[model samples]
Target chain A: MKIAFTAKGTDWDSQMDPRFGRTEYILVYDDEKETFESFDNRDIENEAHGAGPKTSQKLFELGAQVLITGNGPGGNAATVLQKAGVKSFIGAGGMNVKEAYKAYKNNELKEF
Target chain B: MKEIVIISGKGGTGKTSYTASISVLAGKDAIVADCDVDAADMHLLMKPVVEKSENFYSGVVAEIDPDKCTNCGICTEKCRFNAIPVINDQHIISSLNCEGCGYCEKVCPVEAIQMNEMNVGDWYISNTKVDNTMVHARLGIGAENSGKLVAKVKNEAKQLAEETNKHYIIVDGSPGIGCPVVSSLSGANYVVLVTEPSVSGLHDLKRVYELVDKFNLKAGCIINKSDINPEVTNEILDFLKKESIEHIVSLPYNENFTKAMTNGQTIVEYDQGELRDAIVQSWEKVKELVEE
Candidate 1:
């Protein structure tokens, strides 16, 4: 399934990867043949608030089934994700992208 | 009679410290307005005991009543902001995405959508230890209408200055050239652009200076941590001269700034050092310019 991972707070960028530090959105697209593709949030700049709801909307538009991230979904952001039928998982910090997807697929993770 | 606004294009540029120190140095002769409504830190240093506080309601947010609603897709179609969505056979409104345009309520065929007033933030008028009227506010998290809240704070500060017959008002403005910054610069007599010596600092400073110039307000520049990168500092000074903007002062990199921040005080109050003197000199030049 296609998924999007959002980094929470400010410090994780230096910890995970320097490029991820300033990125507002990371898109993981899955194909029917079990292949994966990644896209950066910078690809979409025309939308309002840049990476807030528009990122999630773009992921939903791309048919992303799961979202992996480091921060808890709260405020209006959580509501938007819920409405879009996107499954959000929190506490995914320190985990590699592949491991996060594995845990999510096995239903070991909880929704935010 | 004149107002001076202090703003840094980026956060953590010691905008609040300089503003607080200027307020302290200016003493009772000036009224201070903390216009960084989103994350106002001036109060931490100013130590204002709020003499009066009032709730500010900017506008209404649309609320969806699930009980009275049909699982109508009409609301979603009508919403231009994508604020209304259909989930689990239920129609819901995302409060964060809602612009409070009231379009959702008007387009609801079943009358299930209603607009309710929300308390977005609070504004205050207080007495600081420096013996000046301090006006400030806090914007609710994920809240919109910060520009209006800033405008409200400035209006209150102006009113307070008038009531007390104070001639000058010092405003600590928010970062960036967004709506709140514009609101802070709307009626200002002068603007002090606080900048650092970093590349990003100069970039954002130029952006903010353009904004200040757009409003036709006279502006001056102060380079904080100028010694961190003297080459860049010199470049900034040259740019200032080329642009015909006044270079009020350049403060060297000093640990005293962080130390003062840790102690919840301004550099002037923390240590009577060269940094403090530079800030004082900058304030004096600003005073002279505003008076001119």
Candidate 2:
């Protein structure tokens, strides 16, 4: 399964340290091999709450099955995600990337 | 006779706080309008007790009367917006997605589709504690026609200002440079762009500025929480200088702002300290500039 982590960062450097939309990083996890890769969501690099549906759609298009983020999707965006069949894990704050993936694998996170 | 709109390119940029504080300082001298029809918070700060309100209707929504209709999907085929959907054994129109284009009604073979007006929101004229009339509104959840609501609020504000012989009309504009913002800026004398000292702040500021310039309106900038990152603050200052946009003030990142908000008081009222003084000074300068 290809899972995408929608973090509040733009790059790997800032992705390691989460600060909401100020940082820039979207980690794509390939669950079959238990490995993860990251990409820079340049579109949301400087946006406040940049991990909104627009960026989330990009992640979905990149083949992400699961999205991990701090804030829940907005009303309109949530509808779009439901239509797109993308599962979102909201309120996963302060959890490191590896830990979040582990929780998802263990079916510990609830979908929004 | 000047209208100054306070707007932040993004939400939660303290636009309502600045508008409410300025409204207090300009007490009885201006007509205040909260034009942020979507997620309006100015009324929270202004504490306006609604003196009068009226239900506003945008366009008519098409409602299908299944009792009179056949199972034909003619109405669904004609709707370009895809508002019509087949559910259970009846064809239904989703009211939220309906643009009120009347295409479904026009194409209804059995004439079962009827356009019914729905209340989109409520517009109000209220009395605030500062002895001024405030025009604000609440747009219903999933409601369309926010531009219409914003226009109504601004029109009511202007009417009140003219009737009361007010010198200024202060508006708390919505975030983003969308239809509501356009409606709010229409016929405004000046605009105050409230922004933070962040990369996203500057980016959105430029986007909104472009929209304001498209309307040929004069605007100034205020850097809220300028102390968060001095490097980004300087970068913003340099950009403002390049664009010849006047930097009205640089507000430090102060916890008092949140505290004042929690207490439902303007910063000027909550703390008449240094930050309030700075805001007051900026308002004075803004008044002077707009008057010129």
Candidate 3:
């Protein structure tokens, strides 16, 4: 399964972004391939409205089955994720991407 | 015909009051368009009797047929606005959250979803006590597309002005620099920027003025309640001078404005004093500037 984290940078040491829709980067970790890929989310910064829905669509299209972030998606995005069957965990603010993944393994993150 | 829009960067800056008084001064020669559809209060002062009215439809919302639905979750997943939800094993569409994008209808596998045009508001052409035509609208609660409604009111007023050979169309615009305000500024010959002497008043004035400047519209400033804060008033004057915004009038704070509102009369009708005289002079200046 692939896991996605909203991050501030493209690396494992980058801090987890506290915002879902306006996150700077979306880092996906592939468990099977043991590889990390980052997608820039700066385009969403200029979105006048429906940023949450657009970000949710990105996650859906990226085929990320699990989402780990500081803040969960808003109502509109939440509906999309729920219907897409993606499990989400939040409350990872202040932690780096690697640390957040470790916390997820330890069940320290809250399910959103 | 010339269209003069009266807008305040912030609410309660006396935009509507000035519009009402000016309408009284203009009498039958000018028509009024109340473009503040969100919280339309011009009718309270104008006391317009509806001469003609029509329902305004804008945008569309999705509706699901329960009988045709195959309990498929595809529509819910495809809806970007989170408008569709499963209730008792049946997917239902919520009208309020729907953006009327019609994506759900397009993506519905069994053709269970249909897009319906939404009735957002109603527009009216009325006869006011001042012996003039007034075009206004009432937006539905929690409705979107107020900007479209404003456009409808302005168009109706413009057509009325042209047919009647009126010289001016006075528009009372919405507060802030949002979509409705932008719609109000479009195609307007002149803008009357009403403001107060408070800190936030000056800040929001600059913000709204930026929008007006972007539209390249000529604007004049009316400093209402100028005596409340002399320091801020001076700051406003300096900024206006720097921007070369014509200073049309400075009106002192008065309780009679409130009293006149409670009595359902314009300040020009209620006051025989300095406030009335200043508004009259300001209206004269506006007529001269808009004509030029």
Candidate 4:
């Protein structure tokens, strides 16, 4: 299983980015591989509409079974991710990607 | 044919009501286009009978093939929107999240992604209670490219006008100075911006006016509910005078406008008093101005 977290930096220790659609980077962790990968997401800044949906699509493509973020998955975006069978959590805000992942694994975060 | 669009920067300033009344007074010689696809309340007043309806596609989205699976993650890295998420050991693309940038398609190491266009909304051709036809639409929620939809609506209306040999196209436009509003403004011969007598109305009016000025379209103003605040009405008049915006008409506050709507009728059909007269007079003025 793979989990994705919106992040401010391209590393495991990067702070959690609050914005799901406009987050600076997305940090994904593969549980079986025990690997961490990150990608810059600065291109979302020019998106005028459906940013959340596009980002959710990215999560679906990234193989994220669970998503941890500060804000959303807005109403439209939540529907998209829901259809793709991806569950999203909204807690673990202000935590680094690693800490957020730990909280998510512990079931300490709130589902959105 | 002359195209006239009625726009308001703020909502609830009588845009649909006024457009309905103008269509009534303009008779069958006019083609009314309701470009307010965002809310689309003009149909409520005009009570159009459906003549034709069709789906509209604004843009294409990227789709992924899980069969040719190489988990190289190049598409994920190439996507700026973070739209590629892998699920259940199979990687897929979110059509909703895909901006259709086509960057991922080029970078996909295994040639997994393909771009596809999908229907995002519906457009309609309907016969109205006023003996004319209306071209309107309903944009799908989460639909992108509303500007393109607006253009489609206007183009249909213009085509209808030519087919019927109608000399007028009265467009009830969407609020704000966004892409839809800009789309409605394009190729229009006249723009009537409806605003009310309120602080926020004036502020939004200034914004809408700036857009009109930018386009350099021939413009006018209709101050609806002008009696609600005498001070604001005076200020609006003064501002228009200074800015050289034609004061098309100032309509007094009347519950009859709301009552007319509740009965599913335009004020011209429902009432005989001041509000109806004011709208009729405004339409006449618009016609004279257009003829000039």
Candidate 5:
């Protein structure tokens, strides 16, 4: 299963972004491939409205089974993701992307 | 020709009703622009007849072609928005989650992804009961770019005013200090700020005043339902005095305002009473100040 993290940087040591929609980058950890991929996500800021929905759409397209981030998605986006059976793990507030992934793997993150 | 915006810092502060009355008082020579695209209601009272309309497109969303015979899920893997979800072993694009960023189109190996334009809203040009044209818009639910829509409404109103040689552009501006409100303030010559005497009303008034002051637009205040609390009314008066804003008029609490709204009429149209006189008096003041 693929997992996603809203990250501040492109590297494994980067801190988790506090915002779901306005994150600098979306970092994906492919547990199956043991690989790290970073997608630049600052373009969402250019949108005048529905940034949350757009970001949620991006994650859905990424095939992210789980989202590990500091902040929760907005109401509409949360509803869409929840309906799609994509689980969220949010206690990665100050943790780096790698640490957030570890927390998910060790069952240390809080489920929304 | 002058452009005066009617605004309120909070909802239900009589902004729309007063703007309707002002439009009537301004008559056929005024071209009106309902800049509150998010929740436009001025057209309701004016009973506008649409003469022209155009669809507003704001963004794009990506779609997937499932017949490519490759359920490799690579498109889903690269999408930044959680737009694609797999169910029943079939992948689909959830438009709500799609940001239209086009990342999926680039990463798809099967050439199955296509970008489609998003229709965000519609804007209208209509002739109102007042014999002048009104520009208004309705934004689609979950649509982005409302500020741009407001700008579009204003631009259309301005062009209409120039084309018809009208003397005023009466704008019913949106109720906050956000992007829509900012767009309304761009070329405004003056502002008729509507407010109440309640504590929350006063709080919002000050915040809105800061924005008006920053833009340096000439402004006047109208205190609706001023009799609800005398102390707060005095506090509002003091605040207005400190800000050097004209106290255009203070209207007493009356059910007639609500009656006009329920009956789909302006207070000036519903009754030829003291309320109508007060509005007429302030409108003359608005003319004086705009000219000054």
Candidate 6:
């Protein structure tokens, strides 16, 4: 399964983003391939409405089955993720991408 | 026909009361459009008898058929609004959360999802007790498209005015510089901003004026309850003069306004004193400015 993390940067040491829709970057982790890919999300800042749904669409197209972020998406975006059949875990705001991944493995993150 | 919109950036600044009196003063020559769909109160004073009523449809919402039998959860995964939620292992659509985007209907594989038109509100054309036409609307509970509803009321009022050969359409606009307010200002020939001599009132007036300025529309100012705060009132007068906004009138704080409301009579009908004369003069000035 692929996991996505909202992050401040492109690397594993980048701090996790707390916001879902306006996150700076969406970093994807492929468990089977052991590879990481990052998608820039800064362009969503200009969206006046449906920022959540826009970001969720990006996450859905990224083929990420699991989302590990700080605070989860808002109602609209959350609906998108719920429909996309993607599982989301929040409360990873203060942690870096690597720490958030470890916490996800340890079941320390809260299911959103 | 000319359209004149009366708006108060802050609530309880006498927009409705002022509008009621203006309707009475303008009489048969004007038709009133109450665009405050959030909490329509002009009906209380107008006492409109419904002449015609129509259902207002706006946007669309997705509905899921549980009998289709696939718990595959595709609808929930694709819905951007998160309107569909799993309840008792069955996907149910929440009408309130739905934005009527129809994306889920397109993505649903079993064709279980159907998009349905949402009836968000109702608009009415009525004959007021004062014997003039009044166009108003009532938004359904949890409805968010108040701007569309306001536009409906304005368009209907304008059509009614044109049919009846009325010279003006007087609009009672909603508070704040939001969507509904913008809709009210659209195509209006003139704007009458009712304000009080208070800090927040002045602040909101500036914000609302910024919005009006964007539409490049002419505006006049009515300083209601000017005596409540002389210093702030003077400051407001200075701002009006600097902006070249016409000073329509300055009404003092009076309990007669409350009395007139309680009696279900407009200030023009209840008060035959100087207060009534000022309101009548204000209406005349508004008519003259709108005509110009």
What candidate 5 keeps of the native contacts, as a fraction, is: 0.11
Q: Please provide, for model 1 over B156-241, each residue's C-alpha lDDT reduced to its tens digit, 9 standing for 90 to 100.
A: 78768878899889999988877567667755678898899999999888888877764455789989988899888988998899
lDDT of 1: 0.74
Q: Model 4, range B126-203, lDDT digits (tens) per residue?
A: 999878999988877677546567767876897789788999999998788776676677556788989999999999
Measured by TM-score, the strongest candidate is 3
What are the interface RMSDs of all the models? Answer: 16.3, 16.9, 15.6, 14.8, 12.2, 15.7
Q: In model 2, what are the clashing residue pairs, if there are any?
A: A9-A23, A9-A24, A9-A25, A10-A23, A10-A24, A10-A25, A11-A24
Model 5 Cα lDDT, one tens digit per residue, A1-112: 8888998789999877755655679988888998889999877645555555777888889899899876466556688788766798875755788788888889998777
Clashes by residue pair, model 1: B1-B167
For model 2 the TM-score comes to 0.70
For each of the candidates, the C-alpha root-mean-square deviation to the true structure, in angstroms, is 19.7, 18.6, 16.8, 19.5, 16.0, 17.3
What are the DockQ scores of the candidates, in order? 0.01, 0.01, 0.01, 0.01, 0.05, 0.01
Question: With candidate 5 superimposed using the best TM-score fit, by how many Å does residue A83's alpha carbon deviate from the native?
Answer: 44
Candidate 4, A9-103: lDDT as tens digits: 88888877655765678888889999989878767644545566888889899989888887545556788899888898875555888889888
Error of 6 at A3 (Å): 53
Candidate 1 local lDDT, residue A10 = 24
State what share of the real interface contacts each candidate retains: 0.00, 0.00, 0.00, 0.00, 0.11, 0.00
* Model 6 lDDT on a 0 to 1 scale: 0.85
Model 5 lDDT on a 0 to 1 scale:
0.83
Candidate 6, clashing residue pairs? A79-B82, A83-B76, A83-B77, A83-B78, A84-B77, B60-B100
Candidate 1 Cα outliers beyond 4 Å, as residue runs: A1-112, B80-82, B85-90
